[model samples]
Structure formats: structure tokens, C-alpha cells
Target: MKRATSIVALALAALISVYALFLRPKENSIPSPSPELLAAARPLDTYDFDLVLHPDSNQLGVTMHACFQNRWSETLPDIVLRTWAGAYASPETSPAASDELYNRCYPNGFSEGGFVLHDVTINEQRVTPTFDDAAHTVLRLPVTNFEPGQWCEVSLRMVLTVPDCLHRFGRSQGVWLLGNCLPILSVYEQGAWRTDAYAAIGDPFVSAVANYNLTLSLPERYTPFTSGIFEHANGLYTTTLHAVREAALLVYEQSVTASIQADGTRIVCIGRNKQQAHKPLQIAKEVLKYYNQTYGAYPYPVLMVAAVPFAFAGMEYPGMIWVGENLYGQGLDDALELTVAHEIAHQWFYALVGSDQFRHPWQDEALCEHAMLHYVRARHGAGAYDALARLRIAAPMQENIREGITPGSPIDSFHDLEEYTTVVYGRGAAMLQALDVHTNGRVDDFLKEYVRRHAFALASRQDFEITLADVLKEDMRELLIDYLDTSM
Candidate 1:
């Protein structure tokens, strides 16, 4: 009887070991960041950036004094910074390549090259930069001399030669849409630096919320739209922005500004809208009102919408948005209005509640698409929402069904932009819509609580799932597995 009891106990222990080793999810297998690191970097990362734009020479002169606090327990090591401009020079190119129909960025061919860096320094001392092209779009900076919990101040000067193309970091048609032109710190995760490259599809960036103080010098006649508020002084314009991703600057010629007061938030529309200049600002005002009431208040004092012919239909920054000229060229129709709302929705999902856009893009892109649907339902009638659902969600999802793709897959999984749009954006939104139906309108409560829970900080998929389960008072594992294809 004793021997039989001992045999049973050994079998049980062996079974437990097998489950722990092989059956555990990958997310659970990865180690969590140290609590001491989290506590040390308690509040925010900050940057003091100075940039000068010379449109005639197509050059940008930048000097950044970035102070980043180490967010890991392991001390006396190096840090990684991403030079996203190099992705343009790489063979894979930008996200526009995966775009099937629209070829606005490289119309004439891929002739233009990328950016250049010079005068790198660490803590007022010069250091040689090491390139790691294969690992990620990054440059390694040695910080082995510094201790843990220390704020390392690294300064570097760089020059970006803007190509003659309408890209995220190019100038075309007298408009400059400069995105990811700055070398910012890479996100640290799971006791390692996330050094993923800019991919051919999806916005391949993972970042932390940081404050920015910018001083931009530009030509006298050109009006520049920036991610932060500006005040012109002594031949240079200085802007102070807080709690956001990297800064972006868009310069335009023959542009005008219109202002609207929505709940004491100043909304500004910049640049020419050949179709209807006032329409962009009008949509911005209305969308702002609805989102402010539903989700949360637009925390920024000012929001600028610049009507420019950009590579993408619309792009969102912290306090500014870029409205494509393609939508405006055809007039202020449904497409233009919704695109504005979609970008504005990013303010809540992306700018406010940050996520790993590279690894878990569905966190923001998918959520923004669904949030746009909510806006359509609130502003327009049910009919308008149905139409949008058919055009944006239903149609795109049909293609994914034919392609055998799932919505919750990571951004790196998709090869084409259409598939990304169909699966990640469209199907993900559909999943949310279905969840709202399944939960009987309780999804709104979950989202409102989500915003309140993760405002001004980064939240992972697990964080979101835990919050949902807490709200529902039940296990949401089956629902997430079925919809998001998640194992966590």
C-alpha cells in the first residue's frame, strides 16, 4: 500500500512538470520586468530636441539632448536607439510598399535614399556609434559606465536629406511630412531591448511616453505644423509638449489656420483645403465633442489638423493630425469626415493609451477602428453606422475570410498591406463589435474603464485581458482565444 501511494505521487509530480515546461503560453514563459526598474522610472521619459529645416537644401539639422532613465534592474550596460530614417534606405523600405492599390510615395520609382547622422555624444563626451542593421533599425550607445536608476543624457546631431517624394519623411508638392525623423530610445521589454526593424507592413514602432521640448528653425514664409504647441521667438520657434511619442514637423506653403473652441480645447486646422477649407475643422470640432464626452477629455490644450498630401490617408501624432489631400481633393464627403474621426480616435487609443505598435498593433490599430465605428454611430444615425460597417468592416473581413487569415495575428505575420487592413484593422474591429453584441452593450463600460485604467501609460494585451475579465467577473480566455488568437 505504501509503494502504490508513492508511485501515484511521482506520476502527479511528473505531470505537473510537463505542463509547466511545454504547455505554458509563450507570454507566460517570458520574464516580467523587474519591479525595482518600474519603481525607479516611476513617471516619465523626457527629450529636449532642437531642429532646423532648410527646404531649399532639403536638409534637416537636429541636435537632441535626450535624458532617459534606465528601466531595468541590470545596471552598467549600453542602451539602444532607433534611427528609423535608415529603414527608408534599407531594401525592405517603408509600410507603403505593402500597400497594393495606392503608390503615392514612390510614383516614379525607388530612386531616393535615406538619412545621415553625425556628431554623436554621450554625457557631453564623444562616442562612436555602432550599427546593428540586421538585428533592428537601431544604433547602440554604450552606457556601461552609468549605474542603475541613473538618467543618462546623450546628445547627437544628425542631418536628414529629404527625398523628392511624398513619404512619411519626405518633401513633395511644397509640403513636408516628417515622421520618425528623430532617433529616439527603443523600448525595453522582458529584460531586453525591443530592437525590431521598421517592417514592410504595419507601423513597426514600440515606444514609451516622454515629454518633448523642441526648438525648430525654418524658413520665414513656410508655416510648420508640429506635434507640440509653438511660440515664435527670435528667428526660432520653441514648442513644449508632454507625455507623447516622438515629435513630428510638417511644413506647408500657402496654408491657413482656422480655430474652433470645443469644451475649452483649441482645435486648429492648418493648410489649404481646395475642396472646402472649413470642412476639416468642422469635422474636427464635432468629432472632438463626441470623443471627449464618450471616451475621455482631449487632454492636450491644442490639437492641429494639417491638410497635406501625405503618403498615408491620415496620420496621428500627439497633439497634431495629418489629413491627406486625396480625401480633400474629392470634396468633404463621408470618406474625408471619417478619416478625420479615425485619426482623432488615435489620440485616445494610441497617444494616450500607448502600446507596442510593432508587436501588438491590434491594441491600438484595431481599437481605433472600432472606436471610429462608435463615433459614426453617435454622430450620424444607425443607417450611417451600418453603411460604414459594410464598407470598412464587412468588406475587408470578407477578403480575410477568403485568405485564411486571423485578426489577432502580430503585425510581422502579414506580408501585404491589404491583408493587414483586412485582418488586423477590419477583423479586429469586427471582433469588438461581436463582443459588444455578445456582452449586451457592456463593452462600452469595459472600454471606459480601460481608458481610465491605462491613461498616460503603456498597457499590454495581458493588461487589457485582465481588465476585461475583472469587469465581466468571469474568465475571458475563451473569448480572447477565439477572437484575438491570443494565448495569454
Candidate 2:
């Protein structure tokens, strides 16, 4: 009887153990957190990261995964890359055009003159021992060499010296500016250094940032107005930036002007010489409000508008943008307003959302411009918008896009800037606009959604377009196809 009882007990224990093994599940089954290194800085004035910037310089940190070095040779020959920077050995056949000569040719290197890089941090990365030879203050790095799903931070300490840049552009760098002219980690994808779409005639398109914190040290004489309010401040004179979608800084050293917009979203007519800027400021205000109401928050903490002399009409940079000629000084014509609105709108389109500008130009510029055409149409009633769209979009849509189109052609090939500009700036925009129009203007909604989804995230035209298709109906797929495939 005792042996039988023991056997029963053993059977019961075995059964209970089997049940526990199956039901309890495995422990430590959860995976570890992915590797992510955020770039932290003092909200605005407080730089929490490791950037010990020079007190009086115009250079800003490009906080990213790039380590400045000489590794660019891995993708292209040193000479080939050098020509892009204006150090050309061959003149006519140079990938860079003559107009682009000075931008890349810092023969004396970063320290040659204006806003130069003073220091760099080497944390857990290898770099060239000496950046002595024509070092464009470069930290050559395989920014994407680490784990595929990781991120890194880098920052620049830039000083504001518009006159110097103006000297280069004939006129000063304008109040609405967008161009990358500092040393940086060239974007690496598919194992090659990413070049700008117009590498044949212009400079490279530096990658956009995930997050940026700008600290401007301006004189107390100038009213410090940025995208977001001053999060913290030393006193009335200096302040820290809170959080912003995307912003550019504008400092009017010419006057002790001070007037804040009613929305408090901008500095308003703050410059002492604000008269020339009034009408345009009104346009900027109206357009900005329209964008905020329709699209999404503007990117960055400030929209720095510096009136520089004009070589080209205008340009863009990070945290700060420039429009050639003081917007105050210019007459606010529809054409002028359109340019201003277009550049301002870029605050959200290109600045906030990320893309591979090198491989696909239309992904951002064309898209943003396209969105602007719609923006004008929406804000000023369709009639006004329709007329503007006629010369830019409607006509472009009527063209044969595929036949005469070359993948890479010189800008001069077109009869006018309008024709070439349309393909890139006009038609590219029309394609998306037409797509939006087809999807019951759903593309516009998707564009805003795309910006919100990709806020500070990298994507390709294919990435956005595909994701867009997901949001669109099954019937809407043809719209995207026609725009991509059709020339007219």
C-alpha cells in the first residue's frame, strides 16, 4: 500500500512540473533596448552636450553621427571630390561649375577666413591624426558605420557674419537662406557618399537633422526673436530657446527695432528699419498662419531673416534662413510674396521632414514648392491661386515629361529657368499637387501627415510615396503612377 501511494505521488509531481514548464513561459525572453545616443543640449542657451564653442565665431555645430575625417576617398577619388570644393585641377570638365568655385575652394582651409571650425570631439571613433592639408575643418566619418539602428550627435558653434558671406555672393546672404556651407559628415547610404542631385553644377545637400538646439549670442541692442520663446534667459538681453518644430534666426543689427507679432510666433516688425519689411512681414505672417492652420507646426525655434546682397535671389540654412534683399525693402508683389511664402513654407517641408535630397531633388524642393502652390490656392481663394498655378503648374502638366527629359542635364538646357525650374520646382510640385487633386486633395492631407510622421526622420521619395499610397484608397494608386510615369 505504501509503495503504491509513493508511485501516485511521483506521477502527480511529474504532471505538475510538465504543466508549469508549458504554462509559465520562459524568463529573460524580452530583448534588450536598442542602442540610441541622443544629442542633448541646454534647451537653447544651455548647451548640455560637449561643445566648447569659440566665443566670437560664426560657425555652428552640426550635431550628427558624422566624424570629420579623410575617408571620402573610399567612394570617389580625392581629386574628384576636391573639385567639388573649388580646388579643381581641370577647369572645363570639372564636376563643379565656375560659379561654384569659391564655395568649395577653401584652399587655405577652414581657418582661412570667416566662420571657421575651432574644435571637434572624437568619442569611440577613429580619425585622421592630422587634418593639416587643405583640411576644410572636415571630420571624415562613416556616420552610419555603427549598428544599423543607432544614432549619434554632433554640434557646431557658428557665428553670424552675413557680410562675409555676402562678399562671396555679391550681395550678402539674404534674410531667407537655405544652403549647407559648413564642414560636415557627408551622408553615407548604399556604401557611397551621397552627392547632391545637381552635383554637376552645384554643391552637395547635407542631411537634415533629427533634433536641433540653437543658442544665439547676439548683442543686446538687437531684439532676440526666434521660432519659440526664450525658454530661459540671462536677463532681458539673452534668452534660451524652448522647443520648436524647425527655426532659423534673424538678427537685424541695423536698428533697435522691437515689435512682436500678435500671435507671438515671430519677432514681427522689430527692426528699427521695419518699414521696408512691413508688407512682406504681413505676407510672411499670413502665410505662416495659413501653413500652421493647414499643414503643421513650422520647423525650428526661429526664422532668422538677415537681409544680404543678392547673387542668387535667396538661400536656406539650418536654424536660420535668408532672403536676398531686405523683405522690408522689397515691394510685396504676388511673385515676391510667393517666393517669400515658398521659402517660409520650407520651414516645415524640408527643414522638419527628412529626405535624400542628393538622389531625389523633387522629394523635398518640388514637393514643398508643390505644396506652396496649393497653399496659395487655399489661402487666397482658388481664383488667385489658379492664376499663379497656370504659369507654373498647369502649363508644366501639359508637357511631354518622359521623352526629352534627361536624368541628369545642365540647367541651361531649358529655354528658361521656368522650364527647368518647373521640372524640379514647378512640375515636380504639380505632380504631387495633381496627385493631391486627384485623391480629392487627399495628397495635401497626406503631405501634412507625411511631415508629421517623418518629423526629423529620413525617407526617400519612394518611402513617402509608398507610405502615402497606404493612406490613400485603392482607386488612388493610378494618380501616383501617372505623375511618376507621365511627362505632361
RMSD of each: 19.0, 16.9
**Model 1 misplaced stretches (Cα beyond 4 Å):** 1-42, 90-102, 134-136, 273-276, 400-404, 486-488
Q: In model 2, what lDDT does residue 295 have?
A: 76
User: Which number leads on lDDT?
Assistant: 1
Error of 2 at 148 (Å): 6.9
TM-score for model 2? 0.63
Worst 10 residues of 2 by lDDT: 78-87
lDDT of 2: 0.46
User: TM-score of every model?
Assistant: 0.86, 0.63
lDDT of each: 0.76, 0.46
The residue-level lDDT of candidate 1 at 127 comes to 88
Error of 2 at 275 (Å): 1.7
TM-score (C-alpha, index-matched) for candidate 1: 0.86
- lDDT string for model 1 (381-486, tens) is 8999999899877887556253345766667888777778877888788778887888887877787788888877789888889888888787777876776773
- The C-alpha stretches of model 2 lying farther than 4 A from their native spots are 1-121, 124-138, 141-179, 192-203, 210-253, 256-264, 267-272, 299-306, 317-320, 326-332, 397-419, 475-482, 485-488
